[model samples]
Target: MAKQAKAKLDRKGLGSLGLEKLIDILLDEAAANKALKARLQTALAGEMGPDEMARLIDKRLDAIDQSTARINKARARDMAVEFSALARNILSELGAVDPQAGAERILRFLGLRFPISARLVADSARLWKVFDDTETAAQELIQSVDAEEQVLLVPHLERLRLRDRYGEHTGFLLGLTSVLAAPGAHAWRDALMAVLADEPMKFGALDLAQRLSLRLADIDAFLSLEKRKPENRRDTLTVAALLAEAGRFDQALEWVRERPRGMRLIPVNGSLTSVGPEYGAHERRMLEAEILERLKRREDAQELRWREFSETLNPEVLKLYLSKLDDFAEFEEMDRAFAIAAEHEDIYLALDFFISWPRLDLAARLVERHNHDWEGRYYDDLAPAAEALSAKEPRAAVLLYRALVEDILRRGIGMAYPQAGRYVGELARLMPELPDGHGLSTHAAFLAELRRNHSKKYGFWSSVPGGMQG
Candidate 1:
């Protein structure tokens, strides 16, 4: 019988490379080297026959061709990930993106250029420091970061602004400003206001600053800036005009009363701040009411408001009022706060109303009216509310939770990590307190499984234990 072939089909040691690669290497060497080819040809001819030698050569060449095809196929499959992690390392070194560009652009470049996960977009963004341009185009990196995974990028974005540059490069600036200015984006209202003050254009800055200052219940910056030297008649006039326009009559009157007589020659033609005069208590109250009446007189004014009156009143004021109402060792002012809050139909007003009242029965009813998506935390109040519910009626709180969970699942709004986690943990623990014995452990277990299968979707920090807010 003819000698069995020396090459085995099982090419185990070569790892991913298959039988064809081994055959190709051998054949290439023999074909490229005249001495080797001649030597092998002679050996084959002598050992076997002309027909056998020819058949062996054909077999090897065919195998080599097959190996080349396999290599090409593998390359096609990995076309996207060819750069793998090396690309991320490269982007990170590039630092942050330009002030004009966002991190999403960077991630897009990476995904399109190198084929990476979409989530990596934010990682590219981190490499971009807004004021200093370097990491701008790494869309994949920035997206990866923005998906709430890093938790720090949003804050970082919140703080960055171009105090120096101007113009179309404003997109990045817009991105930072948009994020910081977004209602319910963060509790650090003062920091956001400070960033806004640095903007080169008056464009969105004034409005953002106004809303933030109001929400923060702080007119300190406003009052301070007003007191500083006026840069131009227009800037001062604009401030006064807006105050007057807003019907902050008392404040407006005071500023008008304070204006220097030297400026009287400038023109009362401008707003009160341009000339300066102070409004007394009676005048202020009367002016505030007049401004409201004037605003009401304009039918077109409805279109001017961004939100309901309560939502528009500045978060800080509402926050302060609500905190004072809750005053359970927090602060004090229950009666007046509730009286004022109840007069408004606003959900924001309702939050203040409930905080002042702290009645579980009222909270259960009010819960339906509010947007749980509010990024603000009420963890400390949760204990009181939960206890109130437990004391008043466990069944009712449990029922309310059932309704809340259903609504939450149905709406699919993205709750920030801390808030969602607190509610989930508290609810889960309170499951036993509910009328139904269907322990949240079952839901928790299901959540575990869901997370196991879809880690990114389930999100992390859904619930924190031991009553910790972070």
Candidate 2:
């Protein structure tokens, strides 16, 4: 093996070289020695001027070619961490000197080197903070970069926007709006429109675009672009929302009306009736109701909402409609709705309504009345109802708990053993609380029945708590 020559460059000696030459020397040294590479980055950060620091940063960033920056999980992650910090330091230094220019450089770098360096910068809090900080200069950055260059940044910008709650970054949104508003910003528009045209549209992107359109008061432009593309259920819904928000109630009504009507199959005797449209009609109708209210026809809106709620039993729509009413009217109507819910053929909906209303008493009645036909998910509704009813009505509660336990054991659902055993423990506790002459079986009798029928289920037996293990 050939011996490599000793690399010697004094810390003081680095000052003799030009900024570019110093970067070259550092890159050469760091490439040879990983520890020195790591050391020089921090040591030079404080030692160098902002311009020199930017030069160092730019050199380092450029040097991270496909060969150097290629993701290797086997390599220590500390390298990526170090590089990310360097990128942030460079950006901040550049930003301090020239916020607009720095933002342009950052966007350009992100656009050009995203694929290779995305993982390197992924989750870099400092870089994201720089992005957040420079948001105010976002428009200047957009204008500085060419249309093609700005196109490269669309994805990163979108990512930054989506990272925020409701994509509300003011500066980042300004840049997006500029691109969307620009006559030549087709690449930007296409990127957003592509997301909209996705089989399942990207809700975040759609929301950001809508917000931008709203800011620009460009609903017609957005609708025009959407019309050029294939129709989607989500698009229709979005257009309806945008139009409604713009106080274009007549236009909003048209979008809602355009939705395939009656898409939901009406359940007639436990089977779906084929005559109606069903997939997304409920939401469309809800939008129509909202448009009615916006159009100053409050009575029409209320009646439409009430009819939809009665027909579909949609909790969300009901909640929206109720929110507009006074508390007294809301509760009174809720009481009326509660009565109607009890008779719903979909007993689960009735059960859900009672539970949501937190009317445990009414829920118990419904469960007891329809116990035989109750084919609801055990863990979801049954177990929860059992726990709720246990405090007030031990006999009724026992029936629900026993039903859950039996169902689990009958199905031999091993995953549910721990839960079933806990239910058994609840039954054990509740047995002592039973009133005299309660019609339900005693705890001992119930345990005997469980043992006789499910003695082979070792999974259930082993999970029974210490005292309850009969």
Candidate 3:
């Protein structure tokens, strides 16, 4: 039977045989001879057809990609060294199949680490060494790795930036900048410049690029590249903002003023009757205000910001206005601002602003007017406000303190115990001075409520000195 099979097999060429049949024959032969099995594996590694190698490599890469939990910097350097060998071997096989696609796949793997891989790269300088070694290996596999790889590898730059910012190691950031700025590294430089152009020059890139000996001209040139693109040109405000950040205030204002304006008709009594400059009017005005501030045109800046603040009661705008003036003047300004905040339809914002300002007189009045609105939030603000008012307005202060103590016990929040306990002690001291007809619960009744509701809170009991718990 073996002879007949052999004779029939001999009638057909090995290439003509079905792949499964050929594999079965090889397996049978290999099972009978260990040496042949080893030889077959070696041949598959070296002499396997491109299609077969690609399929095996794709399967292997899929496994590596799926087993993401194992990839991180905390792994020993030896492990990274081993993986470098494995990645190189895989890429070498892949390159034989299709160099460009193999390069893309490899770049993609490094490009998107998914989750904590960037963390891994960022956490240690040793891992950066591994990364450098891997880069060298990748270059060997992909002769002349292209500009796209630089784009793909940008997260490394970001990680380095973070490390540099947080004062991890100066050498690493400087070394990286130097390497990226090295001769024949135009792609790296361009990729970095492109990524950074989207971010503010003041925030990061300006200093880092300058560290690498990159001038403002190079940065401006890169920035203009994005501006030249049709899609990016639509957002002229961004370029204007960048120019402002670069201290070209006049140019920035010019760009801001030059934004294309379109006229739009307003609905008046359901008929289109009014025409106004529509596109970017609000944005342009805001930019102009910011530019005027930068130019030290304080009056113009204040006018624009105050107008916006009056219409919106935006606390940030108010803060910006206040920062330019003295602290003594801020209270007066805050009084005016808080009056507007009080009128705002959102009572929560009013309450929050009053309490945060510790405008206790205003807050006490607000709380008294809307006592039922208290739902146990903002005790941090309320507790302190109550304490501040205790000196002169013990009646109002007692009301707030009692409210805070009740809210704390009702909600079972523990962190407020120390502050609440201290306030309770102060309330006990103020009991003698509190007038009878002050319209607040009696000190005896407040003590009864506290013991009734929170007898079990030993932390609170311990914080309050004597028999006040009764």
Question: What ordering of candidates by TM-score runs from best to worst?
Answer: 2, 3, 1
Clashing pairs in 3: none
Candidate 1, poorest ten consecutive residues by summed lDDT: 110-119
Query: Per-residue alpha-carbon lDDT of model 2 for 298-363, expressed as tens digits?
Result: 889999998888876667767887987866799888887777788888777777767765788888
Q: lDDT at 84 for candidate 2?
A: 49
Candidate 1 per-residue C-alpha lDDT over 39-124 given as tens digits, one digit per residue, 9 for 90 to 100 = 44634543664444444434433443234232233343332232332233234422222211224223223223112212232233
Candidate structures ordered by lDDT, highest first: 2, 3, 1
Could you give me the TM-score of model 2 versus the true structure?
0.65
- Model 2, residue 433: distance off in Å is 3.5
- lDDT per model vs. reference: 0.40, 0.64, 0.59
Report clashes for each candidate as comma-separated counts: 58, 5, 0
Number of the top lDDT candidate: 2
For candidate 3, the TM-score is 0.45
Off by over 4 Å in 1: 1-340, 356-361, 365-400, 411-470
lDDT of 2 at 255: 79
